[model samples]
Target: MNIHVEYNTEQNRCWVRMDDWRVAFNTAAEAEQFVERLNARLNAPHSWGMLSDWSPRPGAKARANLRCAKEA
Candidate 1:
């Protein structure tokens, strides 16, 4: 998964995107720190594969498919 961080001039805030998750902060520095902490947690030796661990499981897949079907 890739992480994206950008500052929004119109809103005068910072935004962060990771996969389907998005977050906004009041300041660019706060956004940068959040991204840094996220990277550290993900890259730590004990949680090397933490990203993959968030993947939907079999039951979650079925629920997601059902939700999608309903939305369609």
Candidate 2:
């Protein structure tokens, strides 16, 4: 995702554009803080929950099917 911080002249405030979402902050400091937190989250490792350890039962057919689905 792309993030940009800029001042909104009409609103007299700092605004952060994260992809298609726009958020306004009363001060540039607040906007920068928000961006820092967002960057930290973006850089953090991801968790896949239950799927993290999941795998199809060992079989040629199952592996073939998985590959076909992924290609599609």
TM-score of each: 0.62, 0.62
Off by over 4 Å in 1: 47-72
lDDT of 2: 0.79
Which RMSD values do the candidates have, in order?
8.0, 12.7
- Mark the regions of model 2 whose C-alpha exceeds 4 Å error after superposition: 50-72
Which tens-of-lDDT digit does each residue in 1-72 have in candidate 1? 789897889989898999888888888888888888889877777654855655455576556555431133
Model 2 over residues 6-71: C-alpha lDDT tens digits?
Answer: 998887899899998888889999899889988997788877884576564757755654643113
lDDT of each candidate versus the true structure: 0.76, 0.79
Candidate 2 clashes: the total is 0
Instruction: Give residue 41's lDDT in candidate 1 (0 to 100).
Output: 70
The TM-score obtained by model 1 is 0.62
Residue pairs clashing in model 2 are: none
